[model samples]
Target chain A: MKFCSVCSSEVKQRIPHGDNRLRFVCTTCETIHYENPKMVVGCLPEWQDKVLLCKRAIEPQYGKWTLPAGFMENAETTEQGALRETWEEAGARVEISHLFTLYNLPYISQVYLMFRAKLLDLNFSAGEESLEVRLFSEDEIPWDEIAFLTIEKTLRQYFEDRRKGHFEFHIGDVERRVK
Target chain B: MKFCSVCSSEVKQRIPHGDNRLRFVCTTCETIHYENPKMVVGCLPEWQDKVLLCKRAIEPQYGKWTLPAGFMENAETTEQGALRETWEEAGARVEISHLFTLYNLPYISQVYLMFRAKLLDLNFSAGEESLEVRLFSEDEIPWDEIAFLTIEKTLRQYFEDRRKGHFEFHIGDVERRVK
Candidate 1:
């Protein structure tokens, strides 16, 4: 940050007292501007032997198949965020079962929290952020055209856990490879 | 936020196009500064049957005991953030087992991600943000003096799960009452 939002004074990057990392500290108010990782909440909305997927209408892999998800908003639980995202992107209402995957993408300072959910009905359509919305079975999934790695991993684990007859929570890091 | 962090221009609260909530939107730069819930990552550091706790030296609940936790920083996994908070607040090293609790405090726009962890050794003391650091058994816990509701809930769940001979992930909300 070039200027402090609090005082409109020029800020400098420095380690604050008792802190180990450098942060944007205001020159006038001396307030430390801290940036934390944001959570991207979504759900795997499943019906009888099929899961819901949405085609992105926006940039960053537009038109690719993805689970209905988005950056979480304030004053809501993670499950609420997931349900909201699903409804916003796919016009689907789902009952969340449990958190399925927690993927940390440090490269983008974002954490993806995907929950297992039950699709209420088939009354689904493409929302504003989606070009198309549909259901996909195991063999019908667009394996080659998935949107993100986190989605791909969550889907794979879902099928695997279904086969094992036991679902478990997963937490892992997905780092961008240096070129 | 009074000024747009992007352009340093005065911002006004407005609902952006295709969105439902009011956000700080910059008229000059057309930047929508959206605020979201942040994650507080920490762990229940266990050395055998005892768990580590830190007496806060910082404001919110100064001198009261709590688990070592802070805001999850950018470019770090939740587990890494939890471990770092443990090391920084209690000067303890721990190996994380699994995520134990996910508590949503909607009033404050924060999510607590607490994990079950194994303490590495007995060489630990109070860090910069802590007044005192020590281990406590279930019977010796300062139940009435815990710093936050989330911490107390996690500790209570931990002991209950331990007694049941099974540790499971917990997800719930802790709402703040209006005065």
Candidate 2:
């Protein structure tokens, strides 16, 4: 940060008293600006043997397929945020069963929470941020066109567990991809 | 926030186009500052039949007993953050088993993720943010003096699951308590 949000004064990066990490400290107010990882919550909405996916109309992988998820907002539970994102991006409603997958992307400072949800009905369409929304079965999933590593991993796990006739909560990390 | 950290300009709260929530928008640079919930990660260190606890040496719940947890920082996984908090507050190292409990406090916009862990050794002492660090058996826990509701619920669930001989991942919400 170039300036303090509180005092509008210059902010410098330094380790404050009794702290080991460097933080943006204001010159005038001495306020420390701390940044933390954000949570992205969404759902794998199931309909019969298919799952929902949205083609993004926004940047950062525009036009690529992804599960309907976004940065969670304040004053809401993870489940609520997941359902809200589902409705917003896919224009569909689902009943959340349970948390299915959690992937920590430390490279981007984000934690993704994906829930297993049952789609209510087929009356779904694309929202403003989505160019299209559709259902894809296991064999129909466009794996190569998936938008993110976390979403792809979650999808693979879901199908693997489905074959085993049991679903389990999964957790793992997505490290920075070496290019 | 009164001022924008990007340009040191006055900020105003408004609903950005295509966004349903109000955010701090800079008057000069038009930067949208979005705030979201934070994650608090820690471990329930288990040794034999006892779990570790820390007496707070900081504000918010000074002197009250609690599990060793704090706001998660950037560039770290949840498991790493939990282990760091355990070491920092209780001076203990642990082998985390799995995520035991997840609690959402929407009133404060925080999510608590507590993992069940095995204490590596007993060479432990109070850390800077802890007045005392000690272990407590199920019967020895101080119910009324617990610092937060999430910790109390996790502790209770731990003992209950131990009696059942099977532990399950739990999720719940902690609504604002009326005083």
Candidate 3:
């Protein structure tokens, strides 16, 4: 936080009185702003017997496969964030099922929440954020080419649990980088 | 946000020169910070058919009853956030069932994503954030004295959905003051 939201003045990073943590206090209005890390929520959206996935059109992981997901909007819940991202990126309407996975990355200051969702319908087209939208059966997942380790991990866990008819939720930090 | 994360000097707000949106341009280092809202995810833990409740020991909702819930930590997902809150506030362990409710409260500058979880074990007490912890059957909920309307809404929905085994999901903005 470099500029004050209230006064539009330069912000200064300092240890506020009696507190030993970093805080951004506006130099002009003396307003202290707390920076909260953002969250990205989505689902392993599943159709009749297939799971929906998106190929990224944007950089960072352009052309790589991923689940439809993104950052939470200002006034949106995690489910809405997930569903909205699904619609935006893959044009798929989904019903969120169970809360499936929570990937927390404290080092990067981000959290990704994934759910097991059911596809409402099959109609889909690539949005501005996606290169393509496709459904993959359990045996068709491009495991090696999936976008992020987070998406890959969620998918792998989902498929394995789907077979055993037992769902064991897993939590891990994504440390994978796109080549 | 214009300025460096380390130096707090003016950078740039990624908008075009004539963008009407409220934006700041840093005159020093050229780094842009996009300020976004943070999400608070939590859960309402139920044990042996009894709903878990807590008495707030801190301000905001001090001295009132509530479900165990809090902000999503950078170290966990939304489900983990809910589970962590349940354990932290009620000293209870729960298996998160479903994404129960999604609340959008722009006025409060918060979006609370709550889940419905069944207690893995019934033994629980108030954690450091509460003065007390206990369980109440649906009929015994402290409706009028609940700390946050979000807590009350979550519990109410859980019971309502519990009927007919129709544990679907709903999204809406609830405006009720606990005071």
Candidate 4:
């Protein structure tokens, strides 16, 4: 941050009194702008033996397959945000069963929460941010073309649990890939 | 936010194209400032049959008892943040077992994740943000002076689970209290 959002004054990074971390402190107002990790919430919508995936029309991983997910908004529960993102990107509705996977990406400062949900019906289409939306069975999943590691890990654990005849909540950290 | 931190320009709230929510858009640089919910991570330190509680030395609930938790910072995992908070507030080290309770407070746009952790040792004292740090058995908890509903609910559930001899992960929403 270059300037204070409150006073419009230039900000400098420094550790304020009684704080150990460096924060953006305003020169005039002395307000500290703290930044925290953002949450990405979505749903793994299930239909019979298939799961929903969206072909992104956006950047970073355009045209790649991913579960319908996005940055969670304010004033909403994680379940609500997951449902909203699922509907917005896939134009599909689902009943959230429970939180299935949580992955913390410390490299990008993001926490991803993916819920297991039951698809209501097949009347689904791509939303603006998606070029296409479709269901993929375990063998039909585009494993190599998945957009993110978090999604890939979640999908892998999901199928593994499915094969075991039980579903359990999984949590782990996703370390940055060394290039 | 009244000003854009990017360019120090005045900002106005409006729905950006292809977006459904109102965001602060910079008048000069046209930067869209999006705000989202934050996560608060901490641990319920368990030693024998007692859990640890910290008396606040800060505002909002000064002097009220609460679990040692604070806002999750960048470049850290949830487990790491929880461990840090426990050490910072109670001067205690812990071995985190698993996530115990997840509470969504939509009114305040915060998610609280409390892990059930084992207190490593009793060489603990109050940290800077805590007036006092002490362990309390189920019957010795100060229910009336608890700082937040989320903490209270977690403690109550912890004891209930202790009685049941089986602890399960919990997830729920904390609605705004009606006064």
Q: Find the candidate with the highest lDDT and give its number.
A: 4
Per DockQ, the best of the predicted structures is 4
CA lDDT of each prediction against the hidden true structure:
0.92, 0.95, 0.76, 0.96
DockQ of each: 0.79, 0.92, 0.24, 0.93
Q: Candidate 4 clash total?
A: 0
Off by over 4 Å in 2: none
TM-score of chain B of 3: 0.85
List the candidate 1 regions with Cα displacement exceeding 4 Å: A177-179, B177-179
Spell out the clash pairs found in candidate 2. Answer: none
Cα lDDT for residue B53, model 2?
98
Residue lDDT tens for model 2, A65-99:
99999999999999999999999999999999999
Give the CA lDDT, 0 to 100, for residue B158 in model 2.
95
Ranking by DockQ: 4, 2, 1, 3
Report the lDDT of model 2 for residue B69: 92
- Winner of 3 and 4 under DockQ: 4
Could you give candidate 3's per-residue lDDT for residues A1-179 as a string of tens digits?
45675666788889887444578888888887776668778878887779999999888878899998887665555777788888888988889877677676665678777888988887888888898999999889888778788788888889889889887555566653555
Tens digit per residue, CA lDDT, model 4, A1-179: 99999999999999999999999999999999999999999999999999999999999799999999999999999999999999999999999998999999998999999999999999999999999999999999999889999999999999999999999989999988543
TM-score per model (chain B): 0.97, 0.98, 0.85, 0.98
CA lDDT, candidate 1, residue B178: 33
RMSD of each: 1.5, 0.9, 5.5, 0.9
